[model samples]
Target: MMVPCALHALWRTLLPVSCFINSVLAAYDEPQGRVATAMTLDPTPGKDAGPALPEAFVSYAFEFSSFPDFAGNSTSGPNLFSDQLLNNIGNITGTKPYIRAGGNTQDYAVYDPSLPVALVGVIDPERQPNYPTNVTVGPSFFESYATWPGARYVHGFNLARSNGTYGDEDLLGPVEPACRALGIDDRLLYWEVGNEVDVYNRGRFAVRPPGWDEADYVAEWLNATRRVRARMGEACPELATDERFKLWAPSYGGTDNGLDAVRPWQDGIDADGNVVEVSMHFYMSGYGLPGITLQGTLLNHTNTAARLAPHLNVSRALAAAAPGVPYALTEVNSLYNAGQPDVSNVFGAALWTLDFNLWCAANGVARVHMQQGLNFRYASWQPRDTGLAPKGTRPPYYGDVAVASAVGDLTRAEVRVRSLRMESETDAASVPSGRGEPLP
Candidate 1:
């Protein structure tokens, strides 16, 4: 029988390597700024219990900097994994979450098979010097996956190889070592072909021409995935016939203007059997846009749900087009472009995360991979101390902890969201009574 690829992929990301104690979870109440009039959940009598929520529902989103900063580099001081932290994560989630090593930096990464050093300088320090990018990584970079016991890995490869900077051959070099470090087909998840390749034309990487569309992406993706599959077989015998050893591709960003779910359906990536997931990225709002504010962008649930509805609608169509294929938000957070400092890093961000993730499950999204990074303004856990700030949990991590507890054990039962209702009342002048007039 074929493994439930979508659910499996989503499950891997559901557990992340951060801890929010029970006390913290209790402390985080749904923010008072917005309150539902009344909500109810009534399980349907004959509905399939649906997929169970994994032990956790949030996973890590590491930037390319993680290679030297969090993964390898024992010589560079302390790594993100400590016995106490790992234990805390496990205790909170009840299972180890998968780690996704990719972000904007993943697109700029090149593989160096025989480099003498563990890492080469990637990002320009003077120009936002600390940001992770513009570098090549060696095999030692993958060795760090071993540090987290039972923790699976979803490794991203450079897909912007169109300029002859690298080829499918160069891209496949990391697979063998990654497989070895991950116990040779044991803990490795799917290889993401690209990071939001849909927006490549205007994106930071600008890897493709402005005229590029899903057709261009599909053709290149097919070729790359085929090569990666063949290499996986040669590197690990177990993967030769295992369907679970899959590729996730055509990761689209949160805009409906470009290719929609039908693109992957037409490309056959969704139902190919070996392809595990059709993933995308989502954010509540664009950073630095006019009128963008903390209350309006990340804190407002009504605004967020409306913004997310289009993507969810696309996912629903994709599920029908390729029956049994899982749809996932492989990368998601409150805001795009790293996020706004005080807003994305605060308690309200946690509330946003919890509400949004639950909404995904209720709406049939197989998995929601909550994205994070070291010192990123929107990160849930800060891996290293910079200046006066010491490394520790950020406010949004409590959302993850709350999700982990809410999900509990997926193996035993499922968290089935039955229904949602909204009833509005009005008085004289049509303003809500609580605020002195009836609500509109």
Candidate 2:
């Protein structure tokens, strides 16, 4: 069956790798000895297909504590390399990529006004060396938001530290300052309350007591979000209205994890009717997993499809529950835990990224945010020099650039993407075969 997808015409010159562009249909043919197939394109939109997505459909999510390092504060000046890279994509797509300044660290963060720097973090090497396990952001932390001009953002709040008790103020403390900072330039897209709360009840990452299910999560979420809205109303009154006070919610780790991604919605997690998007996280494979290979894991189309099936199911359920609310892979990349070394950092990873993102657009997913951090093996680019890695553009950044160029100039026309069925597990394509009619 042909499904509705959204992507634009491809610019072959911008792609560093071999990607064949035939009219509006763009196909990433694998190297010789892989798979080859002929595919047809249907220009007619499917009955169930949604509208074309935004120009910046494939954006980014920076690790929370790394925001200052990636964007740089007013004092340090914006990271010129970061700006140049993002600008390259914007130049192709006609919209600067939206940034999600949140991740696991967002939940662990605490606002410390007395602190002089933008961020102060403590990384527990045993727990996770890539990101800080405990983090504090000072008043200057908000200054990083203004550094990346024309880039919109979804700022996350500290939901994990709140206990939902009558007097608990941890979750409410950052709302005022956050809203005030975002309100100044209208760069705020939506507020996210937490990150992967579903796993807070299990493993070494456990924070909530055992047996904490969907009900408890929903209640806490409602209480915290309501408080957040109330504080935002006081701090940035213009953004607190029904039209503006929206969130990207239920940012679960996966669909079949500690908590089902669909249950939170069924439990009225968005009881306030302010959840603008149903967001979730995904990792193709975990770092250090046995038998992982570039072609077998990251570059394999069949494996990618199998891994994404659950998220697609959850997206369908979310569509039924929240009608118009979009589904986004707010945090996603090839491998979790900062990625596997050789497999994730190679040129093959760029191919995987191009295939992965186009596949998402074809399957009705509204947006895909490639998650990254400093020195991360799978990161598109290292924002700063670290002990482990130097600051420079990586292979995956080229993949991001290719995807942006493929989905060109959304301001001019409404483009729809469709996947070309391949006979082999290695092949993938996003065909937009005909000239799209101009938007009214």
Candidate 1: worst-modelled 10 consecutive residues by lDDT: 1-10
Query: What's the C-alpha lDDT at position 232 in model 1?
Result: 72
Top TM-score prediction, candidate number = 2
Error of 2 at 115 (Å): 0.4
lDDT digits (tens) for residues 278-306 of candidate 2? 89999998998888877577655556777
For model 2 the TM-score comes to 0.88
What C-alpha lDDT, on a 0 to 100 scale, does residue 280 get in candidate 2?
92
CA lDDT, every model vs. true structure: 0.61, 0.77
* Candidate that would win on lDDT: 2
Tell me each candidate's RMSD, in Å, in order: 7.3, 6.1
lDDT assessment of candidate 1: 0.61
The 10 consecutive residues of candidate 2 with the worst lDDT sum are: 431-440
TM-score of 1: 0.80
